[model samples]
Target: MPGFTLHPFTLLTASTVFMILPVTVQPAITTPINAALHAVAGPSDATDRYRALVRRLADNDPRWEVQTAAWSALISDVPTAVTDFLSPGGGYEKARARASQNASRNALVISRTISTTTATTSPIVHLTAIRASYGTLAEKDRYVRTGLKEAQDLDAKHSPVEQARQQAQQDRDYVADIALHGSGAWVRAAAQRAIQKSTDNDIQEFFKYSWASAAGCDLQAFRMNLVEQDLAYRHRLAQLIVLAQQAQHAYEQASEAAKAKAAAEARLAWSTAADTAAATQASWLANQQLAAAQAQSWQQVHDFAVTASTQQDWPTIADNAAGTSGSWSDEVAWAQSQAAEWTAVYESAKASADALPGANPTVSPSPTA
Candidate 1:
């Protein structure tokens, strides 16, 4: 009697009476959902007929509150079942999924930030490059014009060719100096563009670290523009230098022409003066010779007159000299006449000597006259 077991129906009724409605409802699972649900529902609700019975109870049971409560508890157990289901895939897969989601979100945030930063800063970078290029070009152009003006002024002032040449050389050197800067800018631009375009390790690393910084891509356009400006400036400078050189060359040639003209004029003047001097000397010499000949002819005439008068054979001399006259009186008269004519000729010679440009005439007749 002490070890006797109760009848099955009595045991069932007693179990039902003692059974408190569980707070949690068992999940009406068609099959084993997972371990958590399995503990609550047992294997009974896993079959289709049991799930139908539970549903029928939910719809028609007199104690709806208790039945709903039971079902609710069963439904609440599904979260644990889901947790159990995830177990087969391993914790690593879940961890990997979580990591992937986090990484994607972070990457999206970074991409948006970078894109926004790029959008905001790109215009500024472009503007800065443009301004730099424009400024450089302007400065270079100004210098070129200034140099050209200076060359023009110097030439206008009749500066010496050597001085002008020096100025031109200085201009050329200045252009050369600027050319280096321009060329350097161009070279740097190319280098920057290359960096931007490269797929090298260094560039990738740079991009990785430069998330909040300027990209090589942004700098390339600026560099290229600057270099273009520099080259233009250099070209302008070269043109200026050429102009200055040309001006200097023209000045030198003009100077040479002026000097040649002056020299030629001087030679012409010297030749004219020499010819005048030669003519004057020759005229003076010719005058002197003519005066000497006139004096000699007068002396010969006077000597002949004196000899005839002294001979007193003047009648015979006269007869011979006259060739058709006859008397001693006539002869005396003719001799006196001849003497007077000789004296007259001598007086005329004396007057001519006095008329000479620098003459000092001292006239005395020969004793025969």
Candidate 2:
């Protein structure tokens, strides 16, 4: 009774009531099984059964950390351990419990991340995390591992941090260009002072964030001085027109680049969602099957106990069988919940993929004189 579960039936006073059903003699039991049915099996053909279990576990849910751990433990070290592991109250149940814990933690992590991240400007990370959160345990863990870093990289393309850096660099170029070619004396002085600063932050700050406004000051002075229309004014005005046109060209280029990046990001997100959904779906199916097998196995044990078929083996397994049925039922519900999560992710990703626009043809460059 040390390791056995304490179900009501397990506490039955009469020896006749404690009898285990020996229904495992049927070899391939069809009567709903209770894993207490493990009393029927022996090692005569365990080699074939072991290999079969390996294939079943591998093909069904190879990405499962539990499966991976089992592989590592049994693959090279002790092939013979498979029989005991698959038996009632064996490694299989323990692994299932661990997987359940992992699934619970995954739900918590994904929920927190989903709440923190929104589908605003840069949605790749948000949606990607959303889908992976609902994916298989392996996929969910992957988000916590490398997927988060990858999302950050993708988000950084247009993220505030990266955008700020880009703007600072753009402003530096703008100031240098204005100082050399277009600005009047006052604006040129301002631009030069910014460029000459010891820290790059000064230039970035002067151009954008802090005290001196890049456009309000320099462009105003250039426009004001150009209106005089003297020989110097005319030359500077022509330069300013050229700079304006250049700015327009740069705007169009940035627009096209942004479009392309969005399309590519959307495509990748859809693909990830699709793939994760498929894998999670497969995991759901595998879990379903395992739960069904447990259910049937429990049924067999319950029936065997009622009829008092094999009183000799009853004491050996009575305690373990007490709660196996409940655990099997719980596994079925867990699998269904995971399946629903996968479905939600797949549908959301599919809709987003359909809604996103594709890349457009490149625009022709401006004609030269």
Candidate 3:
């Protein structure tokens, strides 16, 4: 009964007082909030200071909560900025245009950095930074296109010597492939022979454009050697042909002698002579074929060298020459053996033919006489 009773008007007035008190205290609450905002979003010059502060906080801050909050604030704007820059038709185009217009200084700096740091770091890092500074992916792509265009233009402006160098490199690779792997053993051999005979100048100049090193060996020597080897093989072929002709002549003589011999013993001698001559003739034919193959191989190598020289493809000349050295020696040995074998056959045939009655066989008077 002693407690006071509240009226509706009294209750409403009490609620109003509570609301007025909050209004009066609002400034006190807002002061700290405003101060916090100002600190986080400082003046324009604050960017560098803020970055330094963030790094310091991350590196040396003792409080984990403070460090975490600093990191969060630092990265909070990254996603939004990235989205605005990357989204199609976003305001990135203006930034990209500005970047392009102002990129000269940045480009110079980047170039210098690249040149100086090339030995210490990968070039990709500089390239990536350069691309990023252009502001947007589309802008970076344009930059790349422009760079490629300039490079192509430069290549187009290349002097004849440069063009020749490129051609020489290509030619060298081609000749090397053939010399090392050609189907013809003799051609391969010829290539090797040319290499051994290369001149100093040829080696020095030709190797410049080649992928392979020549250790001061002449690449042009291969072609020249091929030509010389071809001549030698041709000479050998000519000799073989003459031997074949002589063997054929012996065969004819033996045939005639066999037909004229009436005595059984003389007939046997004539028959034996004819057989020897036939074998010799067969051997001569084989040698002629071998000689032709060898000649063809050498000729092929020579022709390749000539073509390469005409094109100024020193690499090819060099490669061909170097590739054929071993094979050339083998070819020479084989040729010598073949020559010896044929010579032996020819001598045996000649001896047998000579033992037969001279062109005139003294036929004993016919048995009827």
What are the C-alpha RMSDs, in order, of all predicted structures? 71.0, 37.3, 45.9
Segments of candidate 2 deviating more than 4 angstroms: 1-47, 76-79, 159-369
Ranking by TM-score: 2, 3, 1
> Positional deviation of 154 in candidate 1, in angstroms?
94
TM-score (C-alpha) between model 3 and the true structure: 0.22
1 versus 2: better lDDT goes to? 2
If both were scored by lDDT, which would come out higher, candidate 1 or candidate 3? 3
| Top candidate when judged by lDDT against the true structure | 2
Candidate 1 lDDT by residue in tens digits, 1-369: 012111211111111111112112222232222222222222332233224333433443223232453355335545432223223232212333453454344444334433543313443322222222222222223323353345445545655432111122222222233223211233223334324544342232221222111212122223222222222322232233333233334434556547545433433332232233233333323323322332332232233323543212334323332321122122234234323332332343234324433333433322233
> TM-score: which candidate is best?
2
- My TM-score estimates for the predictions, one after another, are 0.16, 0.31, 0.22
Residue by residue across 248-322, what tens digits does model 2's lDDT show? 344445566576665656555444444444455555656555455544444444444444432123432333343
lDDT value for model 3: 0.35
lDDT of 3 by residue, 90-205 (tens): 22233333434544544554455446543224333443333333222223334454643443354456412222223334443444454464423332333343344444333233
Better of 2 and 3 by TM-score: 2
